[model samples]
Target: MVTTQERVGAEPDFALNPSGQFGVYVHVPFCASRCGYCDFNTYTPGELGGATPAGWLEALRSELALASQRLPGPTVDTVFVGGGTPSMLGGDGLAEVLDAVRSEFTLAPDAEVTTEANPESTSPGFFTRLRTAGYTRVSLGMQSVAPTVLRLLDRVHSPGRALDAAREAQDAGFEHVNLDLIYGSPGESDDDLHRSVDAAIGAGVDHLSAYALVVEDGTALARRVRRGEVAAPDEDVLARRYELLDTWLADAGFTWYEVSNWSKPGGECRHNLGYWNGGQWWGAGPGAHGFVGATRWWNVKHPNTYAALAEKRELPIADFEVLAPRDRHVEDVLLQIRLRSGLPTSLLDADEQARAESAVAAGLLVHDGHNLVLTDRGRLLADGVVRDLLAD
Candidate 1:
């Protein structure tokens, strides 16, 4: 058994879990091109200087080996390969990533292995290769079907590519395929949003995740908004879009498992659920964040730095924070309350329970015996509801 100090030689004390449920998150921070709204730590070929996938794979293997030793006993239940366009690695490259993971950590009998793919970069052959390589799920970014919206977001795929990719994944034996949609882009209209969702539903994917376009600072969208070249998504418009999405998805037999995600039965993304439902997981690769026990840590944002640290046989942890009791309670109320299972009211203090009562009376929440669940109206204000529950 490797001691905690053995996890990251130069870093502060880490690796807080020895047993229990855990997952693995692998980040591939390489994209074909930068998306306007993306602020994630990704580098295109031009930005990479001289970094190569071969070099990155070695670093990833090193990290996973350390993680396996650091958190022994319990096997990983899920593996999520997220990206800077993971599909950019092609089928063989992604297969190498999973091979590295398997060689290091022991996985559960039915581990759900998933990878996020870009529509333009994926194909029937790509999906089939992934299935053959043991990937059980595929998530493709299908932000919008509108050409103008795609251009505005700097997406490279054509309007029909996402729909094509989704169908190919299903045909390639992916039962848990997910398509992501982004609503409320400045140039997008209601018809565009409707058409996009309808097309996604028609594509036979089992899961859909829709999010309002957010203009984060340092992103191209933020710069455009600051220059008055584009308008920020209106709050009222976003709410209306959310309502429309819920109604449409519900009518199509999909259920909202979380505020931003909907899916057919048993089609939910388990790796994401791990993040929301207080499960421990190791996050490898550049800019990935991980949580195990009460402690959370993130890797260095630059891929080069991450790889260099791995070269020294060290975990590329940039910083870590051990959550306090109050912090844990606040996070629990904030996250679990948004889920379908709801938060146990027993976890709330007297003041929070009283606040929950007020929310229930206001129809923002409902009491399912011991749990406090968000009503449809409440999900529209999920953040507010969580705040009210935690308010002093």
Candidate 2:
């Protein structure tokens, strides 16, 4: 079995190794407005109106150049441009950033380049331009189709607009289009969740990411929930909602590849799959995180600071930690269990294997020869299951 100790011991500096499969993540920290539940490092013009995207783009280009020099010789298999709202950066800005990537790295001919965008920000012409710029995939944030739920989430776009955006993307010749939906919000009913799912399927999305709303600490949602201004759904309700999503999407011919992701045949997000499989990826821009094998690093959170560091021709890495062998193994097992691929028996030690057997007997996991995967009930309590399996 491939224990965490063995993997970590063999590759102490996996991040520095040049011959590993590498992915790229570019963060665009600008958003027209922040969602109440969002805590990602995103800035709005109101927050940083004085700063121009031109300077930030140059800084990002410089950072990519420096990263290319430092980490030489890995073919980039996927590129994900995630953001406060990547679409906010008009076509020209995206083109410039993509151009820099091509010049600095070896991108696979069929590399899946995806960008996260809000439906309200997309322009039909702009999406076509993005396609010409080499972006093959687009993930639109269509949190909910219900107007009340949209207001609760502070989303600016309506259901019709979101649908229009998806249609526009398809018309623009995007090979793959994904829709992100959030469920279990305060006052969100089963009907509301079903409506969103129906909308996603009706839109003919290649991929769907349906996440349950979690009251993250420090977010407005959390504050509201704590103050009783908003009520959090019970675990039972959330579980029922998730099960409904699975059954409905599966019936619609979408496969549940990951716990929260469903896709049509051959439509899974390759970049995300790389992450779950413990592959290497380089993250650029403010507050972006990267995992190069066992070593994980993140850039500075402040946009200006990150830009200044890159402007000085330095890697903007603010903090980093090299994972211990056990940590890496635990991560692998945890991530693998969340997918249909399942965790290999080799990844567990004797103790972990025993625990897995117990979990399978308890109906939390299914053991298929060399692989162990979470069952539906197990997925609902995934965090608890991971903790139990990883217990020393």
Candidate 3:
């Protein structure tokens, strides 16, 4: 169990908004093996010692029970199961997870439930079970279709596995399937990306998310880059790849809703939109972060430690921070400006408003009614535009 000292300052210092969206994020820390480039909080089988999915589920149920008490009962609008590799839990394990959620809180009539799966670890039966259990969407990590790129990234899935899995999810009655791609990896050619995107689109999935690969610190990829065994991602090449993917998705009738995500009409991920739009959510599980009322809290990261705390009927909370007004505004501008719908001008101060006008003149932003939307050129430099707008 966590020490009293760890929970001393964990109490939320803020309050909830009492209005807007509410969701839950359940983190699964178990993976068959860790990825070379992932910095997310997850544990591989060897690293987990004697920890198993059964034990983890018991702890999860406890955390959710305790969380319901504090958050009081609100109808949950979304539930996202993310992890080391959720599919590693197999079909029964995933269904048990949803049942655990239902045991504690009431899910909305049309709650958007989702799970992220590894392509190699899934099957038609697995998707079928999840669909039967009320899961509305599946996100597969397709990273890329090139064998060389897969090896460099330490991804184990066959080039075609993600597509097959996506098709399986559709056949299992899931209308929304999302394929995640990591572009600009070392050794990835333009043709390699074309084949990947073509296959993903042809698989009849509705959603696509592509992100530029970053060599994060403390990861194996970072170490390789440090040792010069792996070349750092080139900014210019990444920009080119992103433009190509964007063009291809647009041609296929997919529209960009957020910078890294595209989907056919009405396929945007509601759970993630809850995040980008500042909706409240309970982050249950080891290393999960949640926001509700006014405070944002994250649980202890290690699975063993988290389980210990939950077994004791403790919150497993590591710490929390209350968002001040400025914190909210800065986050509002930072997140809302990245969306296709645009950010309202009223959220900005006079000086920031002046910067927005300057940005519009510079072709980095355009005024859409009272909202400030990024221009096509502006998206390439999205972060820089935010900095210019928020610069003191």
Candidate 4:
């Protein structure tokens, strides 16, 4: 069990708009195999020991019931099931999870429900079942098409399989589909990146998410780089890749709704947009993080411990932080600047207003009347720009 000091004066200084968006993010911690570059809190069957999917479902149901009572509000606007591999749960299993949510809280009439699936784990039959089970969207992990890059990343799906899966998901009647990509893999070349992008567009997916490969510590990729078995990603190369991706996607009629994310008009991921817009959400499953009002909390990392707490009808909170007003404003600035909508200048103090002017003068930002939006160059240095805006 975890312990924490009681917090005083922790009442929410700000309130959520009753009509604002809320979402449910369910994390599935099981994977068939752990990838070398993955650091997410996931476990393979062998590592899971005696943990079972049934146990996870039970725990999830418990949490949903509890949250429904604790967070009384309008029906959820969106629901996203993400994971090590949510498709591993199969159709019936996935149905059960969604059913639990439906029973606990009302879902909006036009709610967008999504699940992340690995290509190899999905089939026409599986997608059909999912469609019948009420999943309206699917996001597939198609990291790369290069054989060497796939092998290095330890992805099990063949390049052909991902494309086929995308087509299959469309055929299954999913209204919205997303294809995710990774650039800057150690051995990935410019040609390889172009091929991947070409294949993704050819799949006719409405939404695309391309991310730079980050060799996080404690992952096998980090160790390999440390030992010189593979070279680390170069920042210069990553920037160039981002530029190429942006140009190509825009030329293809996709707009950059957020840095690293593009979509055809009216095809943005509403679930994710809720997050960037400061909407409240409930996160279920081991290691999931949730935000409600001014309080943000995370669940225990171990499945066993989380399950035990659920069995006892206790919240599995491992730790929490109550955000002060200033902390919330800083986060708002950080998130809004990454969006196409830009951030309002009124949120900044007099000192920050000066930095905003300098940023615009430097061409890193452009004024949208009273809002500050990042230019293409500004997005490449977004982190630095945010730091400058928040600088003392």
lDDT of each: 0.89, 0.85, 0.91, 0.89
Which regions of candidate 3 fall more than 4 Å away from where they truly are? 1-6
On residues 1-392, what C-alpha lDDT tens digit does candidate 3 reach at each position?
33446676456642556788898899999887778999999898788877788888999999999887776688999999999788888989989999999999999999999999999889999999999889999999999889999999999889999999999999999999999999999889999999999999999999999999999999999999999998999999999998999999999999999999999998999999988888999999989999987778888888888888888888888887777888888998999999998999999999999999999999999988999999878888999999999999
**Which 10-residue window in model 4 sums to the lowest lDDT?**
5-14
| lDDT tens per residue, model 4, 185-296 | 9989999999999999999999999999999999989999999999999999999999998988998889998987999988899999988888888889999988878878
In candidate 4, which residue ranges exceed 4 Å CA deviation?
A: 1-19
Point out the higher-scoring one by TM-score: 2 or 4.
Answer: 4
- Model 1, residue 74: distance off in Å is 2.2
- lDDT preference between candidates 2 and 4, better one: 4
Model 3 TM-score (2 dp): 0.97
Clash pairs, model 4 backbone: none
Write candidate 2's Cα lDDT for 1-392 as tens digits.
33333442232243555554579999999988878899999888888746667778888899888777767568899999998888888877787888888889999988989988888888899899999999999999999999989998889998778788988999999869999999988788999888889988999888999998887888888888899998976778889999999999999999998999999999999999988988899898989998875688777777888777777777777767788897888888889889987889898889988998999999999987789988989889888888998998
lDDT by residue (1-392, candidate 1, tens digit) is 22334445544445556664589999999998999999998999999878888899999999988887776456889999998989989999999999999898888889999999999899899999999998999999999999999999999999999999988998999999999999999978899999999999999988999999999999988999999999999999999999998999999999988889999999988988887788888899989998888888888877888889999888888877778889988998888988887889999999999999999999999988789889999998999999888888
Q: What are the models' TM-scores?
A: 0.96, 0.94, 0.97, 0.96
